[model samples]
Target: MVFAPGEKPGSESEEAKLQIASKQIVQNAILRAVQQVSRESRQREAGAGDTPRGSFRPGAGELTKKHEKK
Candidate 1:
């Protein structure tokens, strides 16, 4: 089935809102992927294997540090 020819699609304001929302969704996805790659690289450099697939702790990476104490 398709929309009838006489039926109105939507208002111009609604169309503009939809466009803005779609762009925001795409941008959010790209940013998240970049952040994930950055985190994984840091883990590798720190000698930690791939991060486990689970909830990410806020500051678990700090524990892996080797502080020199006198």
Candidate 2:
């Protein structure tokens, strides 16, 4: 499915392509909106000095190095 440059929906040549392209555009918009909302939620949590998804795990190598230094 493709939309030609400068083509508008309902133009005879763009009929089938237009429908497919329009649907794709709407789906992409919805996905982008969802992503934006999720990012905002994470930021708000971080601004409060809280981990957004809970604890982080240290890599085994880093943990071992720290222990060895001790």
Candidate 3:
């Protein structure tokens, strides 16, 4: 639904806000993927297996150093 100039579908300011929100959504998704990849790489360096379905343990991979037995 296109809005005519000076007559926004909802409100002019609201349309601008929506545009900013959309941009942030895309940016957040990219950031999350990058972080996940970095984590996976570190896991590989630690000799952890690539198992996606198993329960996430603290020391499953790179997290080994981070989570020691209590």
Off by over 4 Å in 2: 1-13, 50-70
Work out the TM-score per prediction: 0.48, 0.48, 0.48
Tens digits of per-residue lDDT for model 1, 1-70: 4444565565345567899999999999999999999998887877544556575869755644365354
Clashes of each: 0, 0, 0
lDDT tens digits by residue: candidate 2, 1-70? 5657887655757577799999999999999999999999999878767544455646623646557755
Report model 1's TM-score to 2 decimal places. Answer: 0.48
Candidate closest to the true structure, highest TM-score: 2
Cα lDDT tens digits for candidate 3, 1-70: 8777677566657668799999999999999999999999998877655556576877446646457676
As for candidate 1, its clashing pairs are none
lDDT of each: 0.73, 0.77, 0.79
The TM-score measured for candidate 2 stands at 0.48
Q: Is candidate 2 or candidate 3 better by lDDT?
A: 3
Q: What ranges in model 3 sit over 4 Å off? A: 1-12, 48-70
lDDT of 1: 0.73
